[model samples]
Target: MNDILFRHNRPDRAATFEEYRAEGGFQALQKALADLSPDAVQQTVIDSGLRGRGGAGFPTGKKWSFVPRNLPGPRYLICNCDEMEPGTYKDRVLLERNPYLLVEGMALACYALGVERAFIFIRRGYELAALNLKGAIAQTHKAGFLGSAICGSGFNLELDVHQSAGRYICGEETALMNALEGIRANPRSKPPFPAVKGLWGQPTVVNNVETLSNIPAIVAHGPAWFKALAATPEGAGTKLFCVSGHVQSPLCLELPIGTTLGEIIDTHCNGMRTGSTFKACIPGGASTPYFTKDHWTVPLDFDPVAKAGSRLGTGGIVVFDQSTCMVAATLNLVRFFARESCGWCTPCREGLPFVQHTLERIESGRGDLADIDILREHVHKLNYAFCALAPGAMGPVEGLLRLFEDEVREHITGGKCPVKG
Candidate 1:
């Protein structure tokens, strides 16, 4: 079966509503509205095992069902379009090429979650995506597919595009909600989960752009059809793996979740550059652990990646060849984490710089072994701070220390960067 979601992403003008409808878009919406019950819709998604494609691979249907069905106030669905992770930019492609797919998906999710108002929280940096999405929103509203009495089904719905003042922390669900409500972007404590006390203290469901894009498909094809799309035992469905760095073909390729890292490199990506040996890859964006050449056999999925002591974060497969210095690579990643820190808590704000400085010192061959110990200690102390930022910041640092200690030692003993003059 042809993968429909990314099929329209080539560099021409994006498909508008009329073009999308001509290509069988919104048939799923009509089917969903006319045939499926909200509970049935939720159940179909659960059975499909469609995990969120965002950094956190939370189960999608389960996240939606968290909203109280009978509870009466307004419920909201927010599509998280803040794609700020380093080495990750697939969401931008999705939003830019097929804004309607995301809108259709969000509308379907709103139907499933008993939500009437939905917002696509787009990042300000993505000016094109923001503009495209706003135009799509207007089209959706005018076509009777959105707004009051949608599709003549008497199901009133409203979809809006809200631009976020580009901040990495705003990608977090709670922080996204807080920002939506005109507050500073900071993560709210859980327990009174967003399903309960969310945006304006009402039920809210915040899903990643890719996650919401799967909803219309799930509703169109029954759960079994969607489940059979995956080539792995973990689940079904094709995923967009955005590969970058040192690879012969660096682009976003859609493959089944069970596709091996080696297949992706050798087949889709045309392997690492001709002279470069594949030293390692961060299987899933910046937060995942470094997978050595030995892990080429590991399947690319949430459970398998985690079983191998890493995660399939955002499905960003960043390749590193032999010429890349591990010490310098680690320093660069640490710098990203430090700079993106939201300053909401002390650990992320204060500790990240400390970690970055220590890593730079050790990598530059001007530090003691005690620096490694301090790095480890501070990572542990800082990781559990207020949000996922600090914890996520530890990923590359931990992997660098654990997987390439000898490389660090080599740099230290040799008194300079191994890859540099």
Candidate 2:
């Protein structure tokens, strides 16, 4: 396992701050503050071709570039650590192992963008991670890596670890900003993206926990070295995949970006559990479309997964065995999304519930043949929801219709879950 992001997972406990520093942890920040210009740091990331790990594969550097550097009262940096996406826990794992990485990385980001303050919007459920981060913050503050004039570089950054009363929508950057500001966690419409105006109407950059963690390495090593870390030429760096469901050994594994799904399953996960055969898998998180055995060979990367009719969302893999009912599985996922709706828009608020009902009816053997068509229509319509939440909510259902249409029809015709037999 060529693990870059998660190379130092100590089963005993998280590495101490001194141990991290001794192994050349904060050297990246030191280099950034003393040697490189802000533009230089940003350009290094851009050149490395690092894309966001949090669902959307937006270029991290481009997202940073959107922050209007000049016209700002108090430009802010936020790490979206409120990881509530179903089947996704890479951020939580990263923080549990080493919260210092995120701190160092965010500090580098603040310097790169000339921001004086940053926030880590962590989930309340992640009590351990939150505590570790709080400890890391204190250690950094005392070590002069955080707070006013960090490392004597005239870069003042105050770090706040906000253990959010988390909702799934708070994972959204704009909604996270709203939550940080103590407003409703509903997503704000993007015309002025967060980079232009966010977190108190100031220029901001909201990056995923994993995204920020990559900054230290990118700054420490050159872009070419980072780019070369991937198995695929087009892909950059390693991706942490939280593998779960029917896999024999369910655990998070860090593989080079663009590692094939088959490799991850056969090697890291040790394939499916006993008495089970691979039927389907959610290639990323719950919000991504499903992939079947036919797609086992597909590369588990952003572009390739999209090309395979799913997404590399959070790089979390949820395996499904042959005994699983697609309709029921999708229904369970849809229910979580429906319940997490912020009620800011109609399609997510109204559309998801209706979709969930239809799925339940079908799964319960009460569905009409016409209900399948209704689900298809709803999937298309929900894509236009105010935020990506609604569309994301439809991903599994869409996969069911596309990949398991025959199974859905069987449930209607056989009057029960046919896959059970």
Candidate 3:
């Protein structure tokens, strides 16, 4: 139970700056500024094997390394706090409980990446989290941990919180940059990737809140200690899991990486709710495929979850009971994604609605066997969409067609939802 993130979290309210510093908060920043070189800081994280916790699980240090050292002009660091994924709220919880962690982590990141400017692009409706962060930033500035010549190390950094106007697509890095720039928030194409050309065509490294928040600990404790915190050999660090739906205790908690799905449900969640039997779950967020009882023993890490036919997306575990209708559930998810589509491309803009329509028809008993094939077809077609939106939107549908095809078939065959009946 080596809780790296939540060790200092208070139960009732956010830990204040004074409390955080008293518990050794900015020591890592001081250590980095005083001793470690930028390259050394980056290398420590690289050795720690810390991957991005923001769905993709990309290597954090490697991502930082992408910024060309010799590139001209100012490089930027953005902590992506846009936790808009369905069933995902770890970022909000983390920020609400301890904003100082992020502040220190960002300063350390700024030092490591040669970034003088940084922004925390938070989603709308997280007012409390944003307010707390603003307070934390001001406190850090007054304490001389932030603002020009921080810690008397001659390292200058300015950090700000930019609350977004609210759009699911803003969670995507390119779209986020556009939104931050006061543009339309449409995702720009890659190849001129963000590390090289981002936020008005400058080298920018965008890390998730949880991802950056680990920097301070990684620097303070060394890579070996961080790597040893995982439950599995391959897993390098702890993960924040947001468990919701049909559980005795639905909560956001931190646990070692590679904890089994079965352990999380049966032990941590205290099993299903009274009189409810486990049917299935979205192992990660809504964007991932489903996990049935048969896959309970599967490790809930990036590679293992992917190998088990689902992505460990955002570590958002949404459970469903036997009484739940997989068809209706998937339809609900599709509806949200379709409504949230940026209309940037045809597949996500057009195909998602079509898939939604197809699912509706099946759920309402107006569908045939042919509609099933259509859903299958759109799942593949949407995967080729301009961005991850269309493909992510198709996730539940793909899982429905793959894991619960029988339920869909029953709806069509019985002329109604069997579960509803």
Best by lDDT: 3
Candidate 2 residues 179-249, lDDT tens each?
88898888898888888988899998889999999889888988998998888878999899999999899
lDDT of each: 0.85, 0.89, 0.92
Each model's number of backbone clashes?
2, 0, 0
Q: Model 1 reaches what TM-score against the true structure?
A: 0.97
The ten-residue window of minimal lDDT in model 3 covers 344-353
Counting only residues 3 or more apart in sequence or on different chains, how many pairs clash (N, Cα, C under 3 Å) in candidate 2? 0
Each candidate: RMSD:
1.4, 1.0, 0.8
Q: TM-scores, in order shown?
A: 0.97, 0.98, 0.99
For candidate 3, the per-residue lDDT at 238 reads: 95
Flag the better candidate by lDDT, 1 or 3. 3
* Candidate 2 Cα errors over 4 Å, as ranges: none
lDDT of 3: 0.92
* Model 3 regions more than 4 Å off: none
Question: Is candidate 1 or 2 superior in TM-score?
Answer: 2
lDDT of 1 by residue, 25-59 (tens): 88888887898888888898898898999888899
